[model samples]
Target chain A: MDHQEIIPNLFRTEYRKIVSVLSKRFGFEQIEIAEDIASETFLTAAQTWGLGRIPENPTAWLYHVAKNKAKNHLQRNALFEGKIAPEIKSATSDLYDGDIDLSPENINDSQLQMMFAICHPSISQEAQIGLSLRILCGFGIEEIAAAFLSNKETINKRLFRAKEKLREERIEIAFPEPAKIEERLSTVLTTIYLLFNEGYYSVSQNKTLRKDLCLEAMRLCVMLVENKSTGTPQANALLSLMCFHSSRFEAREDKNGELVLYDEQDTNLWNADLISKGGYFLNCAARGDQLSRYHLEAAIAYWHTQKADAKEKWENILQLYNRLLQIEYSPIAALNRTYALSRANGKEEAIVEAEKLKLEDHHFYFALLGELYTDIDNQKAAQFFERAISMARTQGDKQTLQRKIDKFRPADIPD
Target chain B: MDQYLLLMRLDIITKEAQPSPEQLQVYMKQYHEWVAGIAAENKFVSGTALSTEGRVLQSDKVPIDGPFAEIKESIAGFITIRAESFDDAAKIGADCPILNGEGNSVEVRKITSVNENG
Candidate 1:
């Protein structure tokens, strides 16, 4: 078997199991050593497995190697201190009693515990996500540093210090208590969601979609859904929301790598399988009537995916946005809802609703407002487009707004 | 071929300066162990430990007791190593035992063998 294709997933899952077990056995301070040993194990397998047929059970083969690497690491440390444990020597010499718990359920539980530990709110949100990507997702410090546009040394220092703090505090590798689980779950879900978004809309020059991140997020959410103790209505809602959005992944971008907006996208290119799965998750999310923001967002996305024409879907989207505003009152939601209203009720009603939102500092809000006013033949609203052009961060966004401004002729200006 | 110095600077100011005699002995042992380790690894070159006392030689060949300038990073020690390139020298310098203690530093430099005698 081509181990390269399977190694990353195996490494992520197996490494977490090994680290969690070793951290419990030798204390959290030794987690770095565990990670190093785990890395060496994969390196060994990458070198060794290619020369011969892959083992009968690749996971078992990896675990055996990792366990031995861990033992060797401990023994080397002991030898460096001029002391060696006889039991460790015996265990290394005889691999009979070193059976690792490689069960899928056990592995998932360990990974979930590790995720919780990394996302502990006592740590900064930046540190939490950085550590989670490192420990749970198996992202390297250099990869994460690049993502945050920082140096690798800074990322390494942050991870080192964060782990030290967790060890000092004796942070246990277990799920958060029930009362605090809901609050903690939101942060974890947001991290995973953002990870998927980064993969979906990659900032890197190489490729747009980082399939690894998207798959990892989905796998983690699957773990959440399977666990009876932690699975909640919001978890299902977020997972469904991700699935609905990801269903359009195949059609989101064209052959030349240009983004195709949802209205212009080829619906035939959408993954029907993913759409069905998303629908299933949406139904699961409906079991609880608390109505999360994700639930409303998923409902809106489902409506868009189901509709054949943009004109038929605007009213439902507006209603979903109204419900979303009632649950989570945000300026972005109001701006979005108003845009939908513009398509449903005439430009005048949309502009009236949009004016109520004081979002002068937001560039896209001004751009949307300008577009709405321009549709109503109000050339005076070019000022908002000019403001948007000045505030725009990306060249593409700036160009788009400038084009809107160019369409407003001075001769047709309203005083 | 042109040559450049690969220097490793370390800060030595903090609350842990005034160590007990026993602690100083342990620190010395650790340092020596590190030095031996580097030597065994064949990366060690010429270097020395400096005392806290400040000394100077005047132009007239007279010894002078000097407080020196109020500098934060006083030269603790240094080492010389031969390499085909500056990168190689820097890699060798990275293993220097002088960096074992907290806030200690090891600076490396290339000796400019200019024909000043001519």
Candidate 2:
């Protein structure tokens, strides 16, 4: 590849590894210093590579440069005498003897450690996601801003505050204790899940940016799953859930680029490869007796892949939804279970259950009711649809509800 | 051939002034291209980046820390190139990546010999 593609690819892929390893070595207290060294390494590479002569092994070349820069920083700033301990004074001397130990093992270990570090409970969830995008994914502030539909100053403030928290907490870049691994991993996964959803259900209309967020989530998830220390069954299940959702990403929009509900999506547009891969991960997640929320969500997402509209599929989905609500209740999940109840039993049963939810404020509740009453009572459906359209938050949501209302006239409605 | 020294200066080296690393990586490609352009014309010589910390002495003043004395800007680095005239050298300096903005600039000076070969 030419420099354009190659340089950015390296920036995204290598920047994280270098910064992560450096941070792990220097400790979180010196994270900014590590970041500076990492950034300078790339900048120096730019000047050298701009001469149109790429180092034979660019990654190794980067490691060497970063190592030298780190050493120079240590000596130049006297990091040991003032603040940093002799831990680095000794760890860094190895660079002089040999290499900086950018081994695959060390890099992965550092990155996985960083995944937990960025998800510290001290920061807000949004800030955690933003920090993850910056430090772990090597996303620039500008790109993170575009992804969040936010401006640079806001994102900068968020990141600056979050990094300050990491320092204040003295959060170590390492895995949690075995006893608390599940709890910590859950937080990390929650941030990853939110990051994925932000990309999946975003309103920015920047398709590439949205898709990139999902991809970054997947990359982070894969990192967690591959590492033996943190790769719990729940991690696999979360990865499986992401894979299933990403497989249908392309089909979410129609020929005119309008949103396509899952029921109306073309099966051919779905990626069979990802669907099977999702299944593979789901099976991997089945190992061990643990049944986290991710397992339930993965099962739900897995059933979603059976696009043939079979009664058996809906019944299984309904059962999973019931269990999911029992474990941890969410209004959205409850609303979704109502739809599954409709498919599994009948519209009348679903309408009764949905009405009992009394989620009068949420537009999805009205939309579901509108869908259930379409054939039996077009007038009722129209009223529900009208409420849904009015209550919808975005122009896109209003148009979608309008389309749903338009789909069922006095005839041609679902049973 | 006359040798010209082009001193690179910038008001700021980082934070708001520096582009994102990704942007800088791509932006630095222009410097490579400029160097290639001059090298092809046989005018390129050498370039060196200055360390931020050094001792700077002014007339009848206590020596000051190198870069921070001038709060307005830093003399980042310099490059020497062979040119036919001051105009040619200045023209070459015009393409240096360091001169891209308001306070950022390049100062060009022709090297004068004390003696023929001293």
Whole-model Cα lDDT of every candidate shown, in order: 0.71, 0.85
Q: Give the TM-scores of the predictions, in the order they appear.
A: 0.68, 0.73
Q: List the residue pairs that clash in candidate 2.
A: none
What stretches of model 1 exceed 4 Å from their correct place? A1-17, A50-56, A73-99, A200-211, A310-312, A378-383, A399-415, B1-118
Compare the candidates by TM-score and give the number of the best one.
Answer: 2
TM-score of candidate 2 chain A against the true chain A: 0.92
Q: Which residue runs does candidate 2 get wrong by more than 4 Å? A: A79-99, A410-415, B1-118
**Complex DockQ per candidate:** 0.00, 0.00
RMSD of each: 24.1, 29.8
- State how far residue A169 of model 1 sits from its true place (Å): 3.0
**Candidate 2 docking classification:** incorrect
Error at A17, model 1, angstroms? 4.7
Question: lDDT of model 2 at residue A312?
Answer: 97
